[model samples]
Target: MGVAAPAASATPTDVAPDAVAAPPGDNLALTPPMGFNNWNSTHCRPEFNEEMVRGIADLFVESGLKDAGYEYVNLDDCWALPERDENGKLVPDPERFPSGLDALGDYIHSKGLKFGIYTSAGTKTCNPAGFPGALGHEVSDAQQFADWGVDYLKYDNCNNQGVDAVERYTAMRDALAATGRDIVYSICEWGQNQPWTWAQDVGHLWRTTGDITDTWDSVMSIFKRNVELAEYAGPGHWNDPDMLEVGNGGMTDTEYRSHFSLWAMMAAPLLIGSDLRVASEETFDILGNTEVIAVDQDPLGRQGTVVSSENGAWVLSKEMADGSRAVALFNESDTAQHVGTTAEAVGLPAADAYEMRDLWEHESYQTAGTISATVPAHGIEVFRVSPDGDWAQYPSAVEVGASAVQSEAGTTAELTTAVTNLGRTPAKSVSVDVAGPEGWTIEAGSATTSPALATDAALTTDWTVEIPPGTPGGSYDLTVTADYRSPRHQPRQDSLTVEAQVLVPPGEGTSYVSDLAFVREANGQGPVERDTNVGSVAAGDGTPITIEGTVFDKGLGTHAPSTVEIYTAGRCDVFSAQVGIDDAAGAGGGPPQRGSVTFEVWADGTRVAATGVLNGTAPAQPLTADVSGASFVELVVTDGGNGKNSDHADWADATVSCTA
Candidate 1:
């Protein structure tokens, strides 16, 4: 069942390197190839090399991966013999591969699939005991690969010393040209030396990073580093972020979903490196996420780009085929950080209307001009955008009621509401009414009427209105009433409440700092929050165990703390502290002195009994602490700096011991 070879051009079995000719147009065909590699299950050392390759071939079909897009069954390094012949001839190891490659090739072809082999561009193969080294023998090795019916060549980079990788790669490119076969050349340089810039000219896809471990951190770190290169991948050439480790079990299902979401976004080669014989249900779901897969395989070939990286948060977005865009917001902070995105941040039109879809949850939403969402600690949200037409432009009246927004005093914020056509056909006139808090105002043009919204199934319209200037600040409640041409033919109303606060101008308060965020959950339990903010405290000062953050008056004559927490590695339990602005400088004297307090934090997961008054009146002192034999400690504020009750909380740094 092997695919019929396109008429071979001048099958000159012994042609010289320069004598080879290039195909008329582009010869590369596949894009972001979906395939299976043998390293994960085999650990680069399969017990039954030939048999396992065939078994995986069988699984590829049985698992329905071939129909779902996975096709190639690639054998990684370690399949070759210990050495090449003295005459510089490369051959498969007889003892390990007794039937030789021709029979193996036949076995694979009989199943209606292609065959691929592994080699290295350095002096030795990846395992140091493989047949042909790719260095000076590039031509000979490549020609041998062609003669063995090899359809793909995975050229690794191991033991590569001084030889320029680019030059060595071009040498193999030339050598592969000498062979009459149209082989897919894959470069495995681990993304070092920025191989992506030239990968298109030399191979099908270039590995962008080291081998990805079966851990969430490894997968996430790799995805973050590589998603920006989405623009570099295209039809013939692709940016490979190394093989996938989906089913390999070092991470949870949530992490695996994140892994697939990223790879699909980056358009990296989906060469899975897991045990295909026993893939889990979750693995199938990951490999079969059609919405995400569609983004990777989109014809435009454009990759997602990072727009912002502030306050432990990041946003990535990509333009889609239907004239819409997809976006992903990441909260990389230790504690949950409320975050949002404007149309400008994602290169979308600032027009008053647009339709947005949350890809992870597979739900549609609506926004005025800006799209925003709350990002949980270490969590992410992906979105798809479409223009407005006649369909309801926003989420269901019920769903829209859950939207959140935040604003500072004197900052006028606008929220749009609309309904667009999500159906293939156009609809009659549609409209919506928006209402805000008493002090807020629904400005003119807050409601939009678009006939074009009836054309594209993805079109939407926005209801634009702003919060009143100098309005008393606090979480404001907004409501929208939608009148669409639906069968119900009735107006539906929804409401949302967002935290709003006016902050004291910058340079007038203490600065904020944070610690490295780490995953603290295991197994079926979800990840927990751990605040490790450290500040310098004198050697003998007792550490304050109370936490504080800014708060805003809710117009009810009361203010609430944003968030509060404390951390320490010692047994100091009972604690107390007070919170207030360090107003020793007095009002109009410039920003207040540091607002601080004192409290003791314990090492055990025990609570601290402490009380303090957070008065917005005057500045307070920095939180202080004291103890002996204590190695690590930290003060934490769970609340985001919103308003007057407290100046930005400051943590006095402390030292810790390295003993585990």
Candidate 2:
């Protein structure tokens, strides 16, 4: 009935409490721990008695979670008494744990699983006035758990304060090692200190952040931070972002999927923190996604990294066992955007055709050396890449339609080019260099561009740039190249031909586009758009469009909202746009419908050149905004309602148009 127990700490070396213990076997690391924790479900009152433990063990067996690779059964803090035995041995809280510690251990072992417990480096347990133990008691406690055949220890740092907190944990680690038992120590310090750099020497895994709540933002934020610690995780140690809240209330199933996907990519501990005795079927499916789990347990053990990001959308990639790569297109925006990937980014080929297996949709895509797909907002598309031919036998595919488009506000060209991968395995870091045809100089957004090609992935590289005024307009030819490092070959390069046409100084017409789509509704249903296009314009493919109408929003005196996202197809690689509004005076705090506020959206960072101003109140006249160059468009009104109420704002007559 209470939250299931948390596992034992996984570091028990004879050094300081924070010293990393020898890794627990290759077993746990092979697939982040898939068990559960008690903190999210029961908080401070999780019951860890023998009977409760047995019930959870039964659920683990019956739910087929054990068959799905879930092992360790852990207990968080609060199972100990305030006093120890005369011989400096630890004692169980008599009223809570009537059976001897050994009996509980034997029962868990009898269930064909492992058992774990919790403790703190401070003088008290998680309870401010409860049973907390310092050095001697800490060591003695580890000995007791070890003597009882515990497999893991979750060492929390609640109520412990000092400048050298890491050192304090290290002391307990040494004490545990003295017992001669191989117990995995888990450091639950809540990321107060940067544990990644040092926790490896102290425990098997360390909590990389504060506790996680069952909210979408909570899950996303934790994951965002985990990416920052990718370099510090490896075979013996992992980053623990607390535990999973998959079955807990608050977030939706899609949100949980995102949570799981991100954790797997980060190669973090897979401890579940929910009530499993009666979890829903949806929760079971999420917990049992073996394909996604495979990526997490990839033998390389290298955590996924963010190669690039705009707004909240992220491009994550991980190395696989066969020297191939797994790439993920992710959308983190509140709305939706377009998402896509190329072979070069995955380290494949630039001149040869390739093939891709979309993990999420369970489909296959073939490209003439480049690959691309559209993703929705807050959604993801995971794919496995393999080579289509010999790494050295193929020739670079022909490049096509290389061109540059520039933003009026800056000196950068939005370069669009088509390139291909010729080799077999996937390619990593496909890129292009931008310069003027001859005397013209490249400015702003233009930088080195590379396409991530997976075996036969063929896609276009879409990039943008800002051009400085007074630059002469003329015809210029630019070179586009695909640089990649495949699993079978050292590194290779290919090229494309591009012709830039900078129009004469325009003193007449202004042009642009904003594509629109219906991403979500008020039903609390997760966004219909892909996770990778929450705030971009590609929608799904790299197409162009023009805009010619006026856009307006009516803001209440106290509230205003202004944010929009564009999506292309179901993928999230090409959608992009932005919106903005004039700041109204005397606006109070709240939702957009209740008051005056600023609203705005941007496309490829151009602020959408328009004649009308963003108004906090109704537009001077009914204005129709024309959107172009986007696969889909999303609109958002900030401060739509007063903090205390909902339904304060309304949107109407919004329309979208694309290239003819």
> Could you say which candidate leads in lDDT?
2
lDDT per residue for candidate 1 within 336-390, as digits (tens), equals 4545576667887656556677776666655544555555455666777665564
- Tens digits of per-residue lDDT for model 2, 612-650: 333333432232333345333444444433321121222
Please give the lDDT score at residue 285 for candidate 1: 76
Off by over 4 Å in 2: 1-31, 46-49, 82-89, 93-96, 349-355, 361-372, 388-660
